[model samples]
Target: MELLDQYSLSWIIGLVVALSVTGVIAGLMAGLLGVGGGIVIVPVLYHLFTLLGIDESVKMHVAVGTSLATIIPTSLRSARAHANKGNLDSALLKSLAPSLLFGVLVGTLISGLVSGLVLSLVFGVIGLLVAANMAISKEPAALAETLPTGIVRHSIGTGIGGFSTLMGIGGGTLSVPVLTRCQVPMHRAVGTAAAIGIFISVPGALGFLINGWGVPERPPFSLGYVNLIGFALIVPMTLWTAPIGARIAHAINAGLLRQLFAVFLFITAVRMLYGVWA
Candidate 1:
């Protein structure tokens, strides 16, 4: 049976194998760091799409949109696993959901309007920030035990929504750090961040769908901004692997994982920046 005709059988097999490996790596990182797989997915997809001769002008957008599309299922799986482990904070989720939802909507809209190069640059910057956070070993001395209220939480939620959507990242990169700084335990913060990914992805994805509606250069099997082909390849792989990552998280040394994750982020950041410039 011919699985894919867009390229040679060898190339198709290679692509599928690469994507599967990426899924495993991204899932492991997400589980170990509480991040959305997007940090890894976007850069990898960008390079892969370039190799496949996707248009330079729109390849970044496709990468980001497709990453977000995959994150929907991946995040849901991660959140459920964390919840089962009693790591998720219901009250914090309840308090943060509204703002997060609104932020995603706004961010998606912004993404539709922005250029793909700009999106790539933004992602590079965010990746650097994540790397910086990961490199820092010491926890902040001043930390609050309670969640922020009033305007602060709303502002942070909005920032998370916009940044996450723009880079096709799981909100966890920012959310986990913020929560940790707010005195939440690291493991609990990771769980909460996983839950936030669901809130960010749903509306953010809808916005992409709505915004990309009439664009003429969209790929085969696409809905609005998202390529269904990429989503199909990634979603199942990520979902299946995420729980495995979670299981490993409980069994391994988290500090080592975070350092390894930081190294991975640094590499991805450099690649993304290269894509933006080259």
Candidate 2:
């Protein structure tokens, strides 16, 4: 009871409702598209923390870090669901993991050195580009008969790791496209992307932990950029909802889902960009 007094009833209730909704949506998208919901989660968190009067300087970091924390469990659940369907490319995942890890470390370190406003601007720009790419890109039918070897695979993995860490995503947005370009089947690409999220998040989250160490003026229940409260609110619900998303993905038309996702990305990007300049 005493501990409860620290929070306002209205704020607590709002947080619960908001986080619950976010988890459900994120899970649905992740399961359906094999992309972690960081694109949605990050902006929502940014706005929420702003409303809560968290210091502006650390708000973006908190949002990104907390989103990564949530991705850990959510991505694991998604990967498992896809794996059960025998869609994961285990060989490819193994080949790319090392490069991904190193890239995540570098990205995380760079994130700490940058300003929050700069990060927000960058996210906004990237969001726009992702939305544009998804909206206009034609669906390719060719499939990669063989997995990438040696230098090319490593280079791609590095890009996935670095971009994912910087954007607070699970790497699916880029990974799926790259895999598709390499001629991997759409479903296989989604499953492989889900697997990549786990690889990316482990080290990415660790980077946030190390980068934000001992920073003053951080919120309560925070470790560097991550807020434990937000993580606790999101992870369980995201994990439970992921498999459901996967099931829906199998049922839904892929073209429709992609269009819907693109629209959502556009809206999110516009909102974030508006906030950056406003």
Candidate 3:
């Protein structure tokens, strides 16, 4: 197609190789951080799009949407792997889904109305805050033994879904902290977050498809903003590698897991912040 003509064959091959590598890292992040790899995927897409010389106006939207699209399979794989270890919280998964889906729609609507610059700032700032929180690993003030019920669940789910959709991330960055604060163990929090990513990513990706539909200057092989080629090449690698991260997560000590994941978050936080300027 016309999109294929935009680059030389060798270049396209190179891009695929690079994207495959991104998928591997994304899979590792999905397992290690339970953030559904969206954090890694979004920024990487942004950079790759820039390199590909895609139209500036739609680059962020395409990046976010495609990242969300790829997240579906990746999340499914990572969650299943985590579940195999009996780490997931089934009750929490049921409670979070409905509200999270609603919030994703709300966030998608909001994204269409805002500028890409604003979204970049939002993602950067929030990512930095989330990374800082994880790195610190402070115990919650109340050390609440049970997850809050009713409106609190709504509040938490809505916040995670809306924000994650906008930033093209799984809701895990927020979910893990919430679970841990409720006195769930760290491993359970990670496992549960992996499951929650499925809920957030599926509806969130669909919302992006609908919201960005028919917008101008989108790159080829795209449904709304989700890039077909990128999705095709990345999903398998993500599926292949997510289990590796899960294996490592289960094998690592709590303190080691915390530190390993903290360093990743910190590095990604800086990369996201840099997106604003780039």
Q: Provide the TM-score for each candidate, comma-separated.
A: 0.86, 0.84, 0.84
Candidate 2 backbone collisions, by pair: 143-183, 144-183
Candidate 1 structure quality by residue, lDDT tens digits, 175-266: 88788888888888888898899988777777777877777655555788787767877777777776788788998888888887788778
Better of 1 and 2 by TM-score: 1
Show where candidate 3 strays beyond 4 Å.
31-35, 81-85, 137-143, 245-278
**Residue 248 CA displacement from its true place in model 2, Å:** 5.9
Index of the highest-TM-score prediction? 1
Which pairs clash in the backbone of model 1? none
What CA root-mean-square deviation does each model show from the true structure?
3.1, 3.1, 3.1
Tell me how many clashing residue pairs each candidate has: 0, 2, 0
lDDT of each: 0.80, 0.80, 0.79
List, residue by residue over 190-264, the lDDT tens digit for candidate 2.
898888999888888888877888986666678878877778877877777878988888887866787788888
